[model samples]
Target: MEEGIAIRAENICKSFGEGDSYIEVIKNASFTIHKGELIALIAPSGGGKTTLLMMIGCVEEPSSGKIWLGDKQVFADKWLTRETRKIRREKIGFIFQAHYLIPFLNIIDNLTLLPQANKTDDKTARAKARELLKYFDIAEKEKAMPSQLSGGQNQRVAIARALVNEPQIILADEPTAALDMQRSVDVVKMLKQIALEQKVAIIMVTHDERMLPYCDRIMKIEDKTTIFEEQQLQKNSTHSD
Candidate 1:
């Protein structure tokens, strides 16, 4: 892995079942995500996009191969440590297609709960949550319940929640899937801004090609292999003409 790379996967393969009933979701896949880049994982349905993301997030272990997050080698054939959950909590953030906010809890509390549960002082967690809400332009809605917020506001709160821990890498699975076109663009733009401003690497899985323009790079999965194309390449080629 290169210096400052937030995630590196080496020849990862994930399989389920055995013999005639077996399925290989990801095959010999490898890639690296650098700090501060917003990348999109693009693939068709049942193409292992979520499987790959789950593996990288450490929520699901790979059946074979190696994985690294930042400077730590978190997986190699088997888990390198028993602290996978701790590593995930401290180093990774997650956003999903749904906001998944606690409906009963207000926005501020929703963001505060995880960090506090992780042993951050209550006051500190509250402070950090407030800061994140402000950063995401949802500070005024801190006291509002998730159901009270609009779709965009709710998603903003979710993003704030993800950032409250100051994680180095964020894994987003179709975060804008349920939103309208403009709202989807807004959410993805927010993610890109967060990646650059906070210097956090983000991998967002999406089937929407319209969102590709906002990504720093596009990664496509095919036959268990991953390929990348830098968005800058097109701009550079155009400028050189």
Candidate 2:
């Protein structure tokens, strides 16, 4: 793998069932996601978008092929390391369609809980959580419960929670699926900013074509294979210059 490549998958294949009942969801799918890039994954329903993301996140195993996270070859036909949970905790962050915050906890506590669970001291965890909240422009809502915030505000808090651990890669599954058009755009823009500012690789699975413009690149899966489509933003920039 290259020095700054955060994720690399080679000849990955995932299948379910056996013999006559077998079904291959991903076949020989391969791609590389570099640091400081926001990549969108798009495909039809049952097209294996989530399966590919799950494989990379170490939540699901590929039936065959190799997977690399950063410089480590973590999966080759089977997981190389037994510490999948630890790897997920330290190196990967996940954002889903739902905010999934603890309903009973207030915003600040919700953000601080995970870090505290990971053994970070309360003072440091609280400080980090506050810093992230401020960065997301929701610092004043620290005491507000999830139910009190607007959808966008709740999503921002979720993003803050995802970043609190400072993971190198963020795998987002349909993150904007529940938001309005404007809010969706805002969230995608925020994700792009986060990718560039933090130099973290973000692979987002989305069905919304309008959100593709905010991404650096797009990967579409079909028939168990993957294809890359560049955004051409740089091309337009050079032409405008």
Candidate 3:
């Protein structure tokens, strides 16, 4: 793997079912994403943007391809190891439209869950959770239940929870979809901040064009393949120059 590259996908393809019922979602899609970058992935509904994100996140198996996270090859035709759950827990963070915070747990507890499951001491987990809450500007809501916080606040906590594991890659599926325009913009800005400050690679799946400007680059899924928009533009411009 090249230095600073956070994710690399080579000739990736995905399909569902088999024989007559098989449906292909992605094919020959290859791309590299570097650390400290926020990438917007856009496609029409049913266009497999989410599928590509999932494949990179290790939640969905690619029918054929190779995927590398950081410096390690995690998948080649099939997963390199069977411990994908461990891989995800240690390497990837996920955000979704629904915040998915545990309703019964307080904000602090929700954030501490993953660390504690990895055998981190309770005190250490609590301290880490508090630090993340403070970073997200929701320190005061640490003890609040998900119901007590606004949607945006809950989403903040959700983002904090994702970072509790300090993942190298974050796969966000329509994270700002439910928020209003202002809040959506705020969330994307926050994501951009996280990518730069935390030096994590973030792939955000979104349908909203308004959010694209906040990203460092755009990855478009069309015709069952991936395109890096800015790189292509740069290449074209260099030729025309």
TM-score of each: 0.94, 0.94, 0.94
**Winning candidate number (lDDT):** 2
Ranking by lDDT: 2, 3, 1
Which regions of candidate 2 are displaced past 4 Å? 234-241
- What tens-digit string does per-residue lDDT give for candidate 1 at 124-240? 999999888888788899899999998889888888888889999999999999899989977888888888778899999998888888888999998778999778533222122
Give the Å error, residue 174, model 1: 0.5
For each of the candidates, the C-alpha root-mean-square deviation to the true structure, in angstroms, is 3.3, 2.6, 4.8
User: What value does the lDDT take at residue 227 in candidate 3?
Assistant: 92
Name the lDDT of candidate 3: 0.89
* Model 2 TM-score, 2 decimals: 0.94
Q: What lDDT score goes with residue 190 in model 2?
A: 84
What is the alpha-carbon lDDT of model 1 when measured against the actual structure?
A: 0.88
Which 10-residue window in model 1 sums to the lowest lDDT? 232-241
lDDT of 2 by residue, 1-241 (tens): 5799999999999999999999999999989999989999999999999999999999999999999999999999999999898888888888989899899999999988878868999999999999999999899999999999988899999999999999899999999999999899889888888887888999999999988877889999977899999885542221232
lDDT of each: 0.88, 0.90, 0.89
